[model samples]
Target: MPSRLLPPAGPARALAAAQLVNALGDGAFLVTSALYFSRVVGLPPTRIGLGLTLAWAVGALAGVPLGQLADRRGPRTVAVLLAAATGVSVGSFLFVRGFLPFVLAACCYATAQTGLAAARQALLAALVARRDRTHVLAHLQSTLNAGLAVGAAVGGIALHYGTRAAYLAVFAMDAAAFLLCALVLLRLPEVGPTAAPAAPGRGPRFTVLRDRPYALVTLLNTLLLLRMPLISLAIPLWTVTRTDAPGWLVSALLVLNTGAVMLFQVRTAAGVRDLPSAVRTVARGGALMLASCAVFALSAVDAPVWGAVAALLVAGGLQVAGEMMQSSGAWQIGFDLAPADRQGQYQGFFGMGVPLARMLGPLLLTALVVDWGTPGWLLLGALFLGAGLALGPAVRWAERANSALVSVG
Candidate 1:
């Protein structure tokens, strides 16, 4: 089968480098966007939050449909198109300030982001064997985090100059990065459609939801993901209102999280590559997230600057651990479970869940935090803990089902 596509570490590194560049640009934009909205455009946090929600919703809904299209045609072509579109969308923010204009730009960026993600993942699966796919995915994700760390540092410096100037700078960087990604993507080979017919009676894609273990894992991991939006929204607000911690602290938290991912993700994920052990790993990761939430929740109550700083550090570590574990387990399972021809759609479906959570989690959690304070954090902790514990049985079922599939194959 064409000597098993992803040649060796050398080629993989090249692909990964390209991905890192794109991620760096995305990181810069992400850090700056909200600040630009609030400070420069004079928009409220609520409007900024709504814009993010709508953008993520659009991204999630587009995943499977875009995956289907990529499968029918080739992922490379779609990847190039998506990357170019992302550049334009990000660049448009330089000119647009009104809510409608911003929303349109966000929609464009979201759609392109979703398309690129599905295509790149499908590209990797097409190029590599199932066993290697997990490793590659982990490496790719880790590198992306590293790039983000670098990007955010640069973005911070840029923002110090002026918010509008910072947005313009990030826009340029993002556009350039997308262009580079498109160029790299064009060099890759195509992976065609699944072996099963796209026509009906081949069973529906939604049937994948019936895989009880996979579904539970998704749910469990998602609950742990609460830390992301919580930290993203709350910590900054906390710094502003509760503590005298400087803006650099927020940047530090992000750096800590990304740096941990870059350093430990591969080593940490390597041991859990197999299906049997991945479940245990995910469960442990969930525990880490619960711990992180507890730290965050407690820190909310009359914390000193140093204490809050310590909390941020602890929280960042826990977040990286959870992200590493869940990312590894998800990649391994998705690669193993997917049919030879359906990798694109499978990965696309897996990815859709995150954006869906991002869409709903922010407003809900933020509002709760506003109304309840410490009680809100306590409730979030309980929810995450329950989700983590619940994953055990689900993982057990998935492992058994996975074994059955292997036997049949």
Candidate 2:
């Protein structure tokens, strides 16, 4: 019965299906990417990291322009083209023999992926009502995780085989998935640009860069997103090195996170109907994350193995709760605060935070929490609390400014 509670038919379902397929491919690729590059492709570890890092940077830079293009053209059209490009770029990885070719292929894949994401968000905004956007987003997130879980399992087969041919097969599957996703997108109804004509000299180009309140909100949301690395990278390392918990608990923690999102992401989105409610959701999520941080700190204590495992489970649950809440709230804020006409550009700018977090989070968390231990966790908690508290005021400021702009116009 719960499985039957799907997204409504039409564009929403289509988009969700496409995202599920694409994300499944991403999940498979992610599992094998590092190993495939190093072992199969024969690139050095440092080169792989460097290439991926440069790729991400290139992708981040591509977002704004591609999003703007989506606004100028149709989002559906742009999205389809970008998806095709992504598939081609990813498939090209099979031919990469050295650092330069690898980096080049990575940049292409990352750029297309980023651009496709912005286009997809804009397309979603076009298809769904403002009131329903966050709800739809929640469903999409759940579907993505589910697909990723399945894909990761499939990828594990290749990992187990540990053969070049098997890895290539996985890469080919990922490429095909992207092309399939593109076909799915083609089935959706075409939605054109929402922007109205600008007055004599006042164009909309780069306007998101100048919007201070929205910019601040994006910054705060990015800080909140640091939870990603904390769970994925730091927690596992901490569990093995510092805690008394068994190594198997690391897998359990990841499953806990993915399982929570699949089960509760949609449920959590129900309460976030308006800007005020969204803001409250984010604040509450921040508090939950702060508490989770403290709990995670407790896991590092000199406790019995069972006690540490219990602490880890509890902390992981809290972190997932916080993630679902914050994610839903952030989607609402990003969608609601943007000028309706420029959703593509605004969403593109908002998305820049993700790549930035991915770039900086590991170093920051490793230095603060991983290296320093309990004090680092406490400091991270303080950061979360401070950022969460600041969100309410920041959102209010953005709303007022937007209202002022509307009245002036």
Candidate 3:
């Protein structure tokens, strides 16, 4: 690992440790869970898919209110509790016998996981300095990619064995990881309520929800976030179907992404100091994504084995570079634009972009980039560019609105 990839020893290290433990479990579980549900639990793929979709929907809706709870109850405390709840949720999967039990456990799992993310962000805001928060977040993201890689390697062992016991063991390990994460989080200092409880009727339930500029920010961030599925979905599908590149290139591409992020995320984040820089970084990222899309589309052109491989490798490099920039810039923008006292709910709200991207990115990208081919890639790229271009004006609108509110107060 590069030294510049993460922050030095302190609370940030502790936070990274907790994140690593949690992600290790998640990577293992993710590799094994669909198989476990189908084979071990005797549920069909359709039921498993439906259950997960419902779970994510419930989880997405729960984020803001639970984040607000973290703000009220002390973020560290809430984070710890939610981590434990995640453990309980995963453990419940052990005895799931039918679709109903599976749905219930899945919902619990998603809700706890979502709430834990929000709570941890709130705690991070309280623990870390404003200027350092995005850098630390980059460290956390790097740690996540590293941990997931390791855990997926471990899960490969279970996948090879293909036994009920092997699947169960993965679940057990995942549960233990979240439980241990709860304990690790206890070492962090507490942060009290960010703001006093508002009197009834004094304000909206979620001020973050009502903040139109923030909502626009989240929407644009979500647009930029199409990168998430680009690697996991668009590239792989495009490779096997549209391009002559070998199937193994998929794994190679993934390795490039994870390794690059693990080494360069913090370095990329170091350049983004405030809103303007974050915006420019994201815009640059968008441009790079457009270039990557063009290269990927070109790979589909008639080419020899080595030529196709070379194009794909170059495209992968460009994509990962854009991914790092977009992630780093979004971290700062999401944190910087939010009110300090509302960091929890605001982060939770901003975090919606992730799930939104997850839910819609696949369907949209598959239709546009994979199925539609060259034009689809170009359209996706242009969408990203438009979002990047729009961000500057949107942010300016946000600043003016915020200033007016401050003047009114």
Candidate 4:
């Protein structure tokens, strides 16, 4: 059962354990952050949002540079430093009382979090064989979901108590989690960049951006990531305002989504071996997402509450299935397409898609699904379907470009 829950006892296991611990803390922090700032710190909602937005922006900008640093300095070392920084940043939030301090702390946390992600991906790329990367990622994702479920439940207790001490304890726990993650990373073997240094005046300084095919893949991958906001932000709102489902269904939907990821993420990843298979998986995920959207839209019809509840359950299941598939495919493709020597930079570039999606997804979904209603939902579905179909061609183009580069070199 332990082996079933994770990979073998090695660096993979350590990484999985680190991810689980970090995610648990993150889950608790995510649940309590808004309330902590609003109620405990007495900051206004607008200020809180602004601070977080700026923080994410800072983090996004820092990703590529920090990733390149990982290439130069070694991923394991860089990841450890970034993890420590994350802990410090989260801990600093304890002192934030006003806008500027909040922004500063949040930005620090976000930047460290983003940089840590890139470095960790590079570390994984170095530690694991290419063939096993996706499988390992799947296990990590399942572990993360399980940790988040547990963390969220624990956080709910604090939230229920609604005390400043509870909020403070949660923050301290999150900070401690980062520190513990850093300690785990410290024990991993050093995995340096795999590629030789570039020839003088030959390679582009920023190889990832210059790689148009990979860029297009990244953009399309971002489209698929719209599911994050759709599930987290849009779905809850939709359930409350647009559908006949009971309010309690919102919590149930979250549980359903998490449960599905825990159950099937690893299983779904088993088939993704090569570029073609990975691309196919992503395309299929897109179709599933489209189906999910359509089913969710159906819940808006004047149906019985049971029917709406049933539709939501179905839709949630489909959405999580799609999520698992897309994640598997993205990891496979991102790792495969990346130049081994520049894994840090390449994964950093790929990682940018998530923040980009987070920045825009909520507004886009709100405008389309919430404001525009069924028409918007259909439009959104069409957009997903089109992107899914386009991913194959995009991947092919990337492969052709890589081949051309290799031939020229």
Clashing pairs in 3: none
Candidate 3 weakest lDDT stretch, 10 residues: 1-10
| Model 2, runs deviating above 4 Å | 2-4, 196-204
Q: What is the lDDT of residue 31 in candidate 1?
A: 75
lDDT (tens digit, per residue) of candidate 1 on 154-266 = 78877888756667887799889998888887777655554344576666654445666666666666666666676677656655555445668876776677778777777
Give the higher-TM-score candidate: 1 or 2. 2
Tens digits of per-residue lDDT for model 3, 78-169: 99999999999999999999999999999999889888999999999999988888889999999999999999898999999999999999
* Cα RMSD, model 2: 1.4
For model 4, state the Cα shift of residue 70 in Å.
Answer: 0.8
> What lDDT does the true structure give each of the candidates?
0.72, 0.90, 0.89, 0.90
For residues 102-194, could you state the per-residue lDDT of candidate 4 as single tens digits?
A: 999999998999899999999999999999999999999999999999899889989999999999999999999999999999999977655
The TM-scores of all predictions, comma-separated, are 0.85, 0.97, 0.97, 0.97
Regions of model 4 farther than 4 Å from truth: 195-204
Clashing pairs in 2: none
lDDT of 1: 0.72
